[model samples]
Target: MVADKSPKAGVQSVERTFELLEIIASVGGSAALGVLAEHSDLPLPTIHRLLRTLSAMGYVRQLPNKHYALGPKLIRLGESAARLIGSWSQQHLRELVERTGESANMAVMDSDMAVYVAQVPSPHSMRMFTEVGRRVHLHSTGVGKALLMQLPNDAISALVSRTGLPAATENTLTTPDALLRDIDLSRGRGYAVDEGEQEIGVRCFAVPVPDAPTLTAISISGPAARVTLKSATKVAPLLKRIAREVASEFDEHAAG
Candidate 1:
């Protein structure tokens, strides 16, 4: 690929190659070469060449059906990112599950949604289930509100205006006024709560993700019956403590 620096700078090959990886990542880890080429607007030969290099580098994998997917190398890289927050979340999450006897998760805001970055399950066969990498609306999740608390009130209001609190369940807070009130409460108290707003019969309590620099949000969720006020009262303090620890560890790592 020759540089077109004589006049208008053309697209860089390395940049386009990473963009193709992003396209694959956007499509939930996998996509066909044709789709990637079309989506990236790169020539088919160029895409094939890039895929070959990426595959060799262990950043991408080629399927038997000729599709390409993000490879384990990305997982290793993400695990490194997670370690940047201290690998203790796994230990803390398990302890939380044992204490509450319900499923728990830690997630971070990915754009306008929250993505489950880590999870630990209760010993029960029937418990709340949230897969890693799952995306949920920021307006309807504890992690969402926790992350929102990081931004200023005016900024949050603007985001709500843009995203619009589309109703997930009838119980969901769709009005801007209601959500703003809830955000204020979450900020004042240091944790966010979901009462069957996202899913009926599912209650969640989320503490503000500490450390604005890492942009991490942490949360715990389970059945409403088990995660009710009485149970939450028991768990809230612990959740806040762990969230602070995670944030503090990340901050220390960054400082070091």
Candidate 2:
């Protein structure tokens, strides 16, 4: 018998390399060769060769435990990608602000927190504003809940265990059970709400960006006086629509 090699072997090799990288990222950015091979369904020798090439290119590193991990070079690439994603979503956020008469925000899940990536403030004088790059606990904010609810229940449990649900305001959910209930509600209703949870008298409505390459959400927030529960009913649809638009933009960019 002769070993068979396909014409598209080079393309397959490239795809397998990216699959390994994605597996490492999914496993918190580090895993042993056996683990990578198990997840990738590729031969151990092939995985080793790819890892060696990736390591030489500074895209992966061998840790003390002999596990391959995402390398520091990925940090620069990730930051640049994040910035571009944020920039691309700004117009959609601005549209959200215009439609809802509230501040609109885009956020992505980073570890155990939700990091604000972009914002478009309401034209009103009394609008809400969260600084770009501000990281907030995932258990309390609207965007946080929106991103969290997209994960599996076990992953959600693990994350909540790591980052305990601390009270951001008196109305914040301070227990895992309560937060989980809210997550369920968000998943059921197609959106999440922060009713004075992150800040007293501030309300927010958030929807996850569907089909996004990463865990991302878009939200609209303002004072309770203006952004009431009724306002949430009105804004949720807009948020969801805009989120889908943002996700489509992401898909297009990824394809390009």
Candidate 3:
């Protein structure tokens, strides 16, 4: 087949291919060709052609059930991207730690969970420690809530239903309605709090990174004694500012 030489056509083809890949990822990393066609609003022949090209390039694979899954080759790309983003945000997270006197973290939503990508610990001995790459439930962590609050209510309901809202601690929200209420409160207040929700005696405050390319959040956490409600009130503005700065830098890098 002759390749289309028109620039506009080439760009559209690239966009459609990526849109198909995103659809597969959004549907749990695997989907039937018909499903991809329906979701992408593209014809079956076009979907099949794109998937064939992607599979030939080792960017996607055919599953035993005849569905297509993201290929192993993409893992390296994802890890590298995560590391770059984490590196870019480290200074901001360190500044957050200095301002809040707590462990500062950056996380992005992965599948149905919030995955920590970077962190900077507080100076105090009794600081919080959420290891990078740790995945937490959306209803039990400040960063999780911050990311979740960006989703529509119906999407949140579907995710809560899929994950079943299992309790991580006594304070964890175990129902969709309760979690939704908290999400609303977080949106209204411009930040989210995990007050002994993920772990007893620990508290966390988080704000979503403004205009982030992905569903990213930044947070500060520590022993409940130190990250008190009053302290969170004082730190929220700082966290938001850092989030904005990080987002700006990220956008600039992506553009460049």
Candidate 4:
């Protein structure tokens, strides 16, 4: 109980509590207590006590089958964090739009989907339109592939098995093998390309935000006629540069 009153003890307890929550999240956001005990450094009793406290606080919930998952309260926190990150990245996305002459957007993986967090539309009359907060499948968008590239093949396979790679357009890669191969190609080129996968006559190019807080990606998208192969080759560098600036902005935000 001294841990509740001592500053140092309280800090350690908070750290351990968050570490356990992260472990639960890392294993897909639900796990048995024994599974958590195996992954954590804390003893079983400490883990149990922390979980009990968290459950009571509504930050973690125990299922009928005895597994624990992140609770609804964390959803409110996650949504607020996403909005903050989105606001911080907007200026960089605007720079990307200016440099590339295309719409620029930022997305982060939310659960099994990629959700657009920020966007700066192209000045041109014909441009891609992705509303902020719109969730899209991981196999059908440029940001999706860039986000998925952060994960291992096995993790992606497990995810694809669950989501089943629903096709958005004829260009969409609907099979796990195809999506993996495309991601591999994207890795070679250091970016992902939509090539009209999300919508006909639209093309998108995306690169992951390095050292980002989450599986985050920034992209430039526009009509395929305007975003041709030669244009895409040139715009990729600008996207990457903007991504670096965005990462620096996030660092500053965290430090402050």
TM-score of each: 0.66, 0.86, 0.91, 0.92
Q: Residue by residue across 124-184, what tens digits does model 3's lDDT show?
A: 9987897887888888999999998898888898788788998888999988889999999
Q: Encode model 1's per-residue lDDT on 117-234: one tens digit a residue.
A: 7888778876778887788888798878887778777877777766788888888999888988999998888788988888888888888756545456777787787788777677
RMSD of 2: 3.6
| Cand. 3 TM to true fold | 0.91
Best-to-worst ranking by TM-score: 4, 3, 2, 1
The candidate, 3 or 4, that scores higher on TM-score is 4
In candidate 3, stretches whose alpha carbon ends up further than 4 angstroms from where it belongs are 1-10
Per-model C-alpha RMSD: 9.3, 3.6, 3.1, 3.2
As for TM-score, the candidate ahead, 1 or 4, is 4
Model 2 error, position 66 (Å): 3.7
Q: What is the lDDT of residue 189 in candidate 3?
A: 96
Number of clashing residue pairs, candidate 3 = 0
Query: For residues 159-210, what per-residue lDDT tens digits would candidate 2 score against the true structure?
Result: 7776788898899999888888899999999999999999999989999998
Residue 147 lDDT (model 1): 79
Report the number of clashing residue pairs per model: 0, 0, 0, 0
Angstrom error at residue 170, model 3: 1.0
The global C-alpha lDDT for each of the candidates, from Candidate 1 onward, is 0.78, 0.88, 0.89, 0.89
Of the candidates numbered 1 and 2, which has the greater lDDT value? 2
